[model samples]
Target: MEAGEDIRWLPRHTVPDDLVFPFGGKDWWLIDDRLLAMGHTEAGRVTGHEIIDAPKGSHEAVALRNALWPLAIPHGEYRP
Candidate 1:
């Protein structure tokens, strides 16, 4: 999405959920109970993707990556 674009989204949960603050950068929070989504138009095409959970805080981004560097999410591994 770009500036001036209107993003429409909804939370995954009906009731308010926990507030997850970003470990770095900003202090935004993510709702634990609600699934999130946003819609936007790009190059004349409308597309959107679901918001997902990031592993807690990314405070140890480098360390986490180094520790699990060998592991990978195989294609279709988590698909229904």
Candidate 2:
């Protein structure tokens, strides 16, 4: 599916300069502020994916969402 159609996209500039790209470390998916699906990395490559049952409104989830919010631009407004 297309990004704007199935999922939102953010421009690279929206990301914080100090934050390492997930592709450079570990990758994760936070869904609905609840589920956390993380991707394991080995030798800079994704090795596997795991899902964690994170609850919505949890401190960790909320903190993560807040940290990411400032770095995200609306999908419709993102350039490049």
Residue pairs in candidate 1 whose N, alpha carbon or C atoms collide under 3 angstroms: 12-34, 12-35, 13-34
Candidate 2 lDDT, tens digit per residue, 25-69? 455666666777778988878888888784642446557557777
Clashes of each: 3, 0
lDDT of 1 by residue, 1-80 (tens): 25553222322242134533223222122333232232344675666543545443333333433343344333334232
Candidate closest to the true structure, highest TM-score: 2
> Which residue pairs overlap in candidate 2's backbone?
none
Write down the worst ten-residue block by lDDT for model 2.
1-10
Which candidate tops lDDT? 2
C-alpha-based local distance difference test score of model 2: 0.62
Local error of candidate 2 at residue 78 (angstroms): 4.8
Candidate 1 is scored at a TM of 0.20
Summed over model 1, clashes come to 3
